[model samples]
Target: MDTPSAAPHRMAPSGGCPHADNARLLARGAVVPVVLPGEIEGMAVVGHEALKEFLAHPDVAKNARHFTALREGRISEGWPLLTFATVQGMTTADGEDHRRLRSLVSRAFTARRVEELRPRIEELTVSLLDDLARAAASDGGVADLRHHFALPLPLGVICELLGVEDRHRDRLHRLSGHVVATDIGPQQVIAANRELVAVLGEIAQARAEHPGDDLTSALIAARDEEGDRLSQQELIGTLVLMIIAGHETTLNLITNAVRALCDHRDQLELVRSGHATWGDVVEETLRWDAPVSYFPFRYPVRDLTLGGTVVPKGTPVLAGYSAAGRDRAVHGSDADRFDVTRPRRGGAVRSLSLGHGAHYCLGAPLARLEAGIALEGLFTRFPDLELALPEGEPPRHASFVGNSVLTLPVRL
Candidate 1:
C-alpha cells in the first residue's frame, strides 16, 4: 500500500504513445497520480486487477454528481474534459439513471439486432473496398485505409442507423474530433459541444416531424414498461455518444488490426491458412492495442484504496483500458506480443478493452462485428497490402483517449 509522496506526472495531452505511457505509469504503481490536459489532478488505474476491481466496485460511479471538484466549482464548464463529466447520457449516468438511459437504447445493440445488421455491414465493407481499389490505382499506388475503408464503412452504417443525413456526416466527423480530443483549449471545446448539440438537436427535431425507421426515431418514440422516455438533453447526448462510439472505436479497431497483422506477417499467415479466424485477429488486436486508451470521470462514491493508493470519495479516476489490455500480470509475459491464435475459450476475450461489468460498452458486439467484417473484406481484397509510410510509421491521433494512428497509408 504505497502512497504518492512524489509529484504526479503530467499525462501528454497529445502525441504520446499509449503503450509507452502505460508502461511508464505501470512501472510507477498500479494506481499512479497524474495530471490531465487541463492540469486537473487525478489517478489512473493501470493495473488489470486493480482497474477491474475498481471499475466493478459498488462504491465506484460514472456520474458527475459524485465529482467533488466539479461540485465545488474547482472544475468549470470550459474544461476540455468537462463534457465527459457533464454529458447527460449512459456514459455519465449511474444506478437507476444509468439503467434507464442504457435500457432505452439496449435493444438496438443486442447481439441479435447487431447480427441482423451483418448484411448491411458486409455491403458497406465491399463498397468501401471498391473505393479503396480505385484509390490504389492512382499515383503512388497508395491509399489511406484509415480515411477510405476503416473510417467510412462504420460511419456510413452508424449515420444511416441514426437517420443522420449525409450532409451532417462531415460536420459531425469534424466535431467529434474536437469531442475526443484532449489537446484543445476551453473555447474550442465549448464551440464544438454547442455545434454538436445543435446538429443533433436538429436531427431530433426532424425525426419528431417525420418519424423514420431508424434508431434516432425509435429512441424518440421509445418508452420502457414504466413509460419513461429520454429527455431532450439525454436525446442529444445519446446521439453524440452513439455517433462517436459507433464509428470512432470501430474505425480504430480495424486500422489497428491491419497494422498489427502487417507488422506480424506470421499472424497474418495463420489467419490466411485457416489456423485462426478473423474473429481471433479482432480479439487479439483489441488486447494488444485497444481502440480507446483512457476513458475518464469514474468517481468513487466512498473512499477506496486501489493498488495501494487511497482515492478519496468523489475523486475522478480514469480506467486505463489500453494499459490493462496488455497487463503482463493478467495476460502473462507474452502479453505485448500479437498472437492471433490467442485462446478464447467460449469466445470470451479476457481483456478490458470493451470494458467490464455494469458499464461495459453497449456497442461492443457491433464494434466487433464491424471490425471482423472490415478486416476480412480488406485483406481478402488486397492480400498484399503493406504500410506505405516513407517515414517509418504514421503519426498517431492527437488524443490521449483515442489509441490509433492518424493515417494508415498502405501500398495496395
Candidate 2:
C-alpha cells in the first residue's frame, strides 16, 4: 500500500490508554510508533479510512507467521492468551485456509441459523430480567445489572448454541475471565488457558461421541464436496473461538449499551418515548463506545507503508477500533457524543464493532438480535431503570482486548 504524504502525528499520553502505560505514540490520522508486549514494536492504524484500507488489503495478511514471537524466532514465550489465539484458528488464517475454516463453520452459523434463535433469545432475556427484578426487590430495588443481566444473557445464548452443559458454566466463566484479564500475571493466565482448553476439549470429545442438534455436533459433521473438514485441533480451537468471540463481545455490547443509555438520559428517553428504535440504540452505542477496544496483532507479510509511516514486516500492528469509532473526520464533530438520533453518514451506520472483510464476525447477527431483544426487554420490564451509582463512576474491566463495564449497579 502507498504511504500517505502527510507527516505522521503522535498520540497524546493518556493514563487511560488500554494497552500499555507508556505505550508508544500514534494518532488517529497518522501511522506512528506503538509499544506492545513480547517486545513487539509496530504502528497503529487509527482513523476510519486507514483502518478500512488496512483490513481489506490483500497483502496485509492475518496469518500467524507475522506476529508470533516463536514464528519470528525472537523468543519462546509471550503473552499467553495472544499466543493461544495465534497458534491456530480462523482468526489467524488467511486466504484458502481462512476460507475453508470459515466456510465449514458458516454452514452451522449462517444468518438463517442465528435468526432461528430469536425466540429462544427473547425467552432467555425475559427469564434473566425476571431474576434481576426479583433480586432488585430483595436488595432495596438495587442490583448489579452487569452480573444479573448483561453478562448472563449472552452466556446463556452461546452455551445453548454450543451445547455446553449447565454444570460447566461457572467454571468456564471464571476461566474465561482470567484468560482475558489484563491485570493478572503470566502464570495465572497460562493456568487459566489450560483449564479453559481442557473444558472445551471435554465438550468436543462428548460431541464426537454422540452428535446432537447443536452447533458443536454440526461442526463435527460438517464436510465440503472435497471432503475437507476441521481437524481435531481445529475443532477445539474453533470451539474456543466461538465461546470467547461469541459471548464476550456480545456481553460487552450489552453492557456498553446500557451504560451509554444511563449516561444519556435524553437519548434513553428518546428510545423509551418511541422516537428511536432499539436497533438505533444498539447501532449508536456500537459506534459511540465500540465493544472491543482494540483488535490486537495484525502484521504485514512484508514491509509496508500505512498512513505516512513504514511498518516493517513481522512487527505487530493493532487496529484501534475504539479510537476509530470516535474519529471526528469520519463521524463529524459530535462523534464523541452519544446521540441515538445521530444521522448516518449515508443512510448506513459504518462501524468496525463486528469487524470487516473475510474475517468479519460470524456471530454478529446473533449478537444484534440478542442486544436488540435484551435492551427492549430490560427497559420495557423496568421503565424506570436507572444507574445506582453516580455518573462517571462505573468501574471498567482492565483488559487489553475487551472494553466493558465490570459492574452496572442499577435501581429498578
Candidate 3:
C-alpha cells in the first residue's frame, strides 16, 4: 500500500529539473499531493496505469468550472496557470462543447489536407537546412540549431496555416512563450494573458472583415446547422490554443529528437543503416521525452480513490505525461534506454505524449508529419552534426509544462 504524506510536495513553478522532480514524486506512489502555482493544492497522477485511468475516467473532467478552489473564490484570477484552465476552447471543454469546438478545426487537419502540405513542408525543411549551413560556416562551424532550424520550420508552417501576418508573428510567439512558462512573475503572467487575448482578438477581427484561404477565415465564416457559431471570446481562445499548441509542441519534438540522437549515436546508426526509420525515431523520442511534461487542471466530478489516494470532488488533477512515459511498469526495466529499434507492438506507438480519449491532440498527424520531414532532411543534409555545447548540457526551458532545451548549439 503506497501512501504519500498528507503534506503536499512543493512543485517548483520553474528552474528545478523535471526528470528528478518527477522521479522523486513517482517513487512515492501513483497519485501524490502537489502544490501548484498560486499555492493551489492538487494531486499529480504520475504512474503509467494511474495516468491512463485519470485520462479515461468520465468523472475526471477538463472544464475549469468544476474546480472547487476557483469556483469558491480561493484561487486568484491572475494565477499563472489560470489562462490554461479557464480558456473557453476545446482543451478545457467537455462532452458536447468539446465535440463541437473540435469539429471546426478537425476539417483543416484531415488526412488529405495535411498531405497537401507535404510539398510545402519539404520546401521549408530544405530552406532551413541551407540557412543552418550558412550560419555554421560563418560562426566558427557552429550554430544554434534550435533557433535556425527547429523553431522556424514549424513556426512558419503554423503561421501560414492560420493566416497570421508577418508583423504579428514575433509578438505572438513571445506572448505565447510567457503563457506556457511557469517561471514568469505573477504580474507578467497576467499581462501576457491580457496581451495574448488582445492580439488574437485583433487577428480574429481582421479575418472577419476580410476573409482569406486560411483557417482563421474559415473559422470566422463557420456556422453549424442551428446557426451556432463561436462567440468572440471563444474565437480568440480557440485561436490562442491553436497558435501556441501548433508550433511549440512540434518545435520541442524536433529539438528533443535531435538531442536524443546526438546522445545515443548507436540509435543514429540504426537509422543510417536502414534498421530503423525516421518514424521510429520520432515515436521513440515522444515516448522518452514528451514535449509537454505536465498539462494542467483536470477536475474530478466527485470524490474517488485513484492509485490508493483519496481525491475529493472538484480537486485539480494534473496529467503527468512525462513521468508516465518513463514508467518501468509499462516499458519494462530498460524503459530509460533510448533505443530506436525497439519494437512497437502491432505498429501502433504507445505514447500518451499526444494524449488520449476525446481530448487527444488534434494536430497529432500534422505534428508527426512535420517532425519526420524535418528530422530526415536535417540528418541527410548534415550527417556529421554534433552538439557544440561547451558548458555541459544546454539550459533546459524553465517551464514545468514545456520539456525542452533553451538552445541546441551544434556543429555542422
Candidate 4:
C-alpha cells in the first residue's frame, strides 16, 4: 500500500456547510487527507475509498480512540465521534457483547414498527402546524417556525418513544441541545451528559418498577427472553442515546427542511401542488441540505491507503457526508441542486450522513416520516407564508455533528 507523504489539508473553511470547500477538493480529485493537526489531525480525510476502508476495518474501534489519535497528532482520526451512544453499545465493535447489546433494541426499528407509528406522526404534525398557524395569526401574521414547530414535533415523538414524561419533554429538549452544543467548552458537554445520564437513570429505575409499552418497557420485558438483555447501566446509556439521537437528528431534519423550502420556492410550489407530494419534500429536504452534515466519527484500525495515501491505524476521520452528497465526480451538477422526484436508491441521496456500513442510523426511517409529515403540513397548511428574515440573514448554529438554523422567521 502507498504510504501518503504529503501534508494534510485543513477542513474547508467551515461555512454553514462544508460544500464549497469540498467542491474545491473534488475539483483536485484527491482531498487533503486527514493527518496530525500541525499535520491536519481530524476531519480532513482523503478520497472516498478512505471512507470505505475506515468504516469496514476489523480493528477500527468507533469511540473516542480515533479522536485521541488525532490529538496525538495522527491525521485521519478515521471517523471517531465524541458523543457516540450507539458505539457505546454495538454499532462500533465486534463480538458477542456488541451483538447481544444491539439485538435487544433492534426490533423496535423494524420497517413494520415505524409504519405502525405513521398515523400518530401525521396527527402530531398537523397539531404542531395548527399551533404555528395560531402563532402566525397572533403575531402580526408571522412566526418563527423553528421555535414553534420544527423543534417540537420530533422532540414530542421521541418522548413518546422513550416513555419520558411528556412534561419532561421541554427539559430533555433543552438538555439535549446543551449536551451537543458546539459553542460550549468540554465541561458543558460533560455536565450535560452527566445530567442526562442521571435523569435517564431515574427513568429506567421507574420503568423497571412500573413498565409500559414504550421502548424502555420493551427492553425491560426482553430481559426474560434474552435473560441478560440489559444491565441498569446499559438501560440508562441506551435510553440516553436513543433520546439524544432522536432529538439531535430529527430536530435538525425539521429545521433544515424548513430552511430548504424557503430556499427553493419551486420545490415549495410543487409540494403545494400535491403532484410533487410529501415524500418528495422529505427526501428532497434530507438530500438537499442534510441536517446531520457529517458522519459519526470513525477510527482506522490498520495502516491503510485511501485514494493512494496511507492512513495510520487509530486516527480519527471526519467523513463529510454533506460534502460527499455534492461530490462532483459522484453527483454531477444536479448534486448541488435539490431534486425530490429523483430515485431514492441512487446518486447523492445515498450520501453517508446517516452513515454507512455497521453504524447506519437506526432511526432514519422514523426521522424521514416525521420530517415529511412536518413539511407537508407546513406548506399545505400555510402555502401563503413568506420568510420574515432575508435569505442572507437566516440564523445558524455551529455544531460538529449538526449544523442548523436557529430560527426561521416567517409571515403568513
Choose 2 or 4, whichever is better by TM-score. 2
lDDT of 3 by residue, 223-287 (tens): 32234767666778889999999999999999999999998999999999999999999988888
Of candidates 4 and 1, the better by TM-score? 1
The lDDT per prediction is: 0.87, 0.74, 0.86, 0.66
Candidate 4: segments with Cα more than 4 A from true spot: 1-15, 28-31, 34-40, 43-59, 63-81, 85-87, 221-227, 272-275, 344-349
Ranking by lDDT: 1, 3, 2, 4
* TM-scores of the models, in the order given: 0.96, 0.90, 0.96, 0.85
Best by lDDT: 1
lDDT tens per residue, model 2, 1-412: 2244443333222113343321222232445555555444556776677778788877687776766454767643336436443646788888888898888777656888888888899889889998998989999999999889988889888888889888988787777777666556667767777788889989977877887888888777763223456776677778878888878888889988998897788999988788888988888878877888766667787887777567788766777777777777677777778988874345554787678888888888888889999999998888888889965766676665677777889999
- Please count the clashing residue pairs in each candidate, in the order shown: 0, 1, 0, 23
Candidate 2 ranges with C-alpha deviation above 4 Å: 1-28, 75-78, 223-228, 343-349, 390-392
Model 1, 26-114: lDDT tens per residue?
Answer: 77778888888766788889889898898889999998889888888898677888888888899998889899889988988888999
Model 3 regions lying over 4 Å from their true place: 1-6, 223-227, 345-349
